[model samples]
Target: MARFTLLGTATIPGKGTELRLLQRNDEFSIKIAGSTGELMNSRLHGSEDALATLACERISELPSPRVLIGGLGMGFTLAAALKSLGSDAQVTVAELVPEVESWNRGPLGGAAGYPLEDPRARVHIGDVVELIRQSPAAFDAILLDVDNGPEGLTRKENDWLYTSAGIHAAQAALTPDGVLAYWSAGQDPAFTERLKRAGLSVEPVTVRAHRPGKGARHVIWLAW
Candidate 1:
């Protein structure tokens, strides 16, 4: 077995949480410094890819569609989104931690074919919520893969993204036909109901972490 090597570390601003990057041979993993679980892995990104593909498919026909992606984990979602959208579309990715972006620009990038190199991609080193609040009705789709889910396992501040107010902000940020998608480690029925209360039609999808028919199950909520 190849022993894991520590690559880099970054502290989550405001939250005081440290994020560590490690590599075992060609595979990379990101985890909270003190946690035993991985936040993201270069190899198990099927669900992340699905998050972008599924959301972009709905808005594919729109002319010059605008898409917002929260969390640039391994660049899988961004790469998947870009592939699904037309060449005229623009994708803006908001990553709370700057180092994560740097990692993508470095060796960590090859896992998703270096999505940041895509000409249509624009990186934002700030909170996704702020972007959602400011861009009212501007995006054709918003995909969020930040944290573990609506439960805020990595950062307490992430809890807001799952709140009624946050949901409404996301609702207001979308075009009339826009979609909002969220990635989770597991299903959250209450979060689905919350989307309903926010007046959005929601669909919860179960996906595999690895390629189809393998690995752990993850959930993605698509609301429009």
Candidate 2:
């Protein structure tokens, strides 16, 4: 085993929270120095990839399907979306912290197969809420993995995305049969009801974080 090496840090806008990049024996991880500890570990992203795979499969029928990925943590979700979608599909990834995209281009690229370099993938270095706000039925699927769960951690404003208004915005941004998927460290029954109230058919799925029933079980809500 090797000790974790601190690589770089990025500050979350408005909230002022910091995200630290760490490396250890070829493994990389992103830790949020917020009240809630470690954010994501590169070695474990099975559920993250599932977030995209589960949603994309339902919407793959569309030609040139457009996807909006809320967060770009370690690029696992983006990489999986690119791998699963068709050649003409477009995946838009919005990452609030620019350094997260840089880390994906630098040390963490290989972990997710350098998805940022893919031609179909578009990277936006801004708040995903803005993208959702601007879009109106512009996407076939929206994958959200910004925080540990529906609740906000890294940024206070993220709470809006999970609220009724945010849910409405996400629904408005989606096509008629579009899918909305969320990756959470755990489950939230209230959130499920909210999705239903937003006029979406909700399907709550529980997936093992490390596959093969290895790590903790994570919940992904696939709403349409």
Candidate 3:
């Protein structure tokens, strides 16, 4: 593998943590400034796509479905959701870091086919919790891929999303038959029970990080 070249860095608004963008050949990676692990890589997004695909499939028949995505990451989830949705569908992406959105608009855009450019896609630069709180039975599907997983790696605040309160908020934000999907690096039986306690039916699906039957195994929890 070739050495990675630093592209840019941005500090997470309230958290004050820095995120670095690096590129090696045609591939791109985003990592926390002091962390050794990559937060997102353009080459691996199978689970990210699954997060949206699994959620979208449930609401595909709705005449004008509305979807909410918690994190943009490399835009893989957003791209996959747009691909699965009909023209009348609208997808709102809530991205905490503005630079991540910018990266996707720039060179990182091509990695996911520039889903943000789609007319049906909307960008919200703020905490996804705020969006869920304000919305009441508004979305047909809500996909969360923020901060790695339920345990969280980048932000401590992300832990709230996995808590019972957060689960209820997500539940209230969904339509009667809406779906909520979460992306995780690994599975958590506790989180599965948490969703059930919040009155949702949970289905945990394992997916590959790179391609089918290849790469790391990740998890996607579909709740309705």
Candidate 4:
């Protein structure tokens, strides 16, 4: 069986440790040592498209909207957001890993399609949670693909993002009628309830990929 090789490792501020970049033949992935979640993917088929679709749908209403995306990953969500929004739209991407950003600029550039070069895009190398906390009704749309799901795959600190307090903070950071979209690897009924508890109008959208035009199945929580 084929396996991934260690590409490199780097420490990120606020994230508290070194993160590893891995490659398997043509594919790339990022994981924190001793952590369970896979961060970025060069395969183009993992978490990117789903996040892109979610952002696109939310930004359809406004021209030149300001969007905030949590987690840069391989830049798939950022690329998709740029493609979907108008030229005037601005996207702020918050990524906790500095090496992931470097990888995207280096070997992962082609796979991500160089989203950072876009004039409307800005990259923040820090915790997305801090950004959300500081931002108050600032973004037209907030798209979160930070962890594997509500259960969290990497750092345990990520649990706050799925909690009632975190949901409230996210809601406070959104403009009135703005959309909050979250991508999960699988469904979580309890989290859906938590969204409702946060006073959001919640909708669960299930999508599949790897089959014809669509392959793997993904669940997206659309809340406002």
Candidate 5:
């Protein structure tokens, strides 16, 4: 067995929370302090890639499609989105934690092929919810993988993103037939109902953590 070594720790603003980064041989993993579960693992990111591919694939033919991706956990999601997008397409990735961005551009970049360097990809170092509240009908698709799910384990502020109000903001930010996708470690029945109550169609997809369809199952909610 490869022993895990603590590489470093980064502070997550506003909650006095610090995320732990661990390295085991060539792999990297991140987790919140005192949490049993890992926030993200470099080796397992099929669902994250699916989050972007599934959303962008639907709007591929649309000219200059704009996408808003929340959480830069790793660049896997962004990389997948960029692959499916056209030349004129734009993808805005909003990451609340600055260190997370650095991690992507630094150690984690090698794993996902440095997506931030893509001209079509832009990184915003702030809360994604704020961006949603500020921009109306600005995106063709909104993808979020913040925390573990709608119910946050990293930051309580993230709770707003899943509430009826946040859903309204995301819905308003999207263009006609625009899709709002959320990635969660598990299922949230109440969140599904909330999406329906907001007048949007929801498709719940279960995907594997690893590509050839292996590893743990995760839920991705694609609402339009």
Candidate 6:
């Protein structure tokens, strides 16, 4: 059996604790035991395609829009967003772990083709939540794939992002008609309600992509 080798580690502000990047042959993994959930290659808990689809769907509506992506896991979501958005669209990816960002730029670049280096992309080595909280209604769409789900898979601090306050903060960061999308491993009715309670229109979408031709199913919560 093949095993993943420990590549490196890094710490980010606001996200808490440290993050480790692992690599096994061509596959990559990221684990932030105290921050966002564990990400194995492109399969995050269970839903990477679902989240990417949701982000792409939201970005597809705009022409040359500015977008914000919370996570850079294998660059799957980021690449999908880039593909869905127009040529003039600009994407800002905020990755908490510097090593994860480096992995994206280094060995894993071939898997996702280093989309972060696209002229339209601006990679930021910081916390996505803080970036959203600091930016004021600047993005046309904000795709959050930071944690496993609102329930969280890594740290308890991530729970704040799913709370009403977090939802409200996300809403405040979006443009008047902007979309806020969240990728979860599975469905959480309570978190769905929280989005609605945040005074935003919510749409729950399901997608499957783990198997080779999109056969695995996952849930995505789209709130605007």
> Which stretches of model 2 miss by more than 4 angstroms?
34-36
Q: Candidate 4 has which clashing residue pairs, if any? A: 209-214, 209-215, 209-216, 210-215, 210-216, 211-214, 211-215
lDDT of 6: 0.76
How do these models rank on lDDT, best leading? 1, 3, 5, 2, 4, 6
Model 2 weakest 10-residue run by lDDT: 29-38
The Cα error of candidate 2 at residue 145, in Å, is: 0.7
| Local accuracy by lDDT, each model | 0.95, 0.90, 0.93, 0.82, 0.91, 0.76
List the candidate 1 regions with Cα displacement exceeding 4 Å.
none
lDDT of 6 by residue, 1-224 (tens): 79878787766555466777877777777776554544566443235545655656766766678888888878877777777777898989998777777888887777777788888888888777789889998888888887778876655666788888888888888888788888877789998888887787888977664743454466788887
Candidate 5, superposed: residue stretches over 4 Å from native: none
Best by lDDT: 1
Model 5 clashing residue pairs (backbone): none
RMSD of every candidate to native, in Å, equals 0.7, 1.2, 0.8, 2.5, 1.2, 3.1
Clashing pairs in 1: none
Record all residue pairs in model 2 with backbone atoms less than 3 Å apart, i.e. clashing.
none
Candidate 3 residues lying further than 4 Å off, grouped into runs, are none
- Estimated TM-score per prediction? 0.98, 0.97, 0.98, 0.88, 0.96, 0.85
Give me the runs in candidate 6 sitting further than 4 Å from their true place: 11-18, 32-38, 43-46, 209-216
TM-score for predicted model 6 compared with the true structure: 0.85
Residue-level lDDT of model 2, residues 133-221, one tens digit each, is: 99999999999998878888777788888999999999999998899999898989999999998888999999988885788899999
TM-score of 5: 0.96
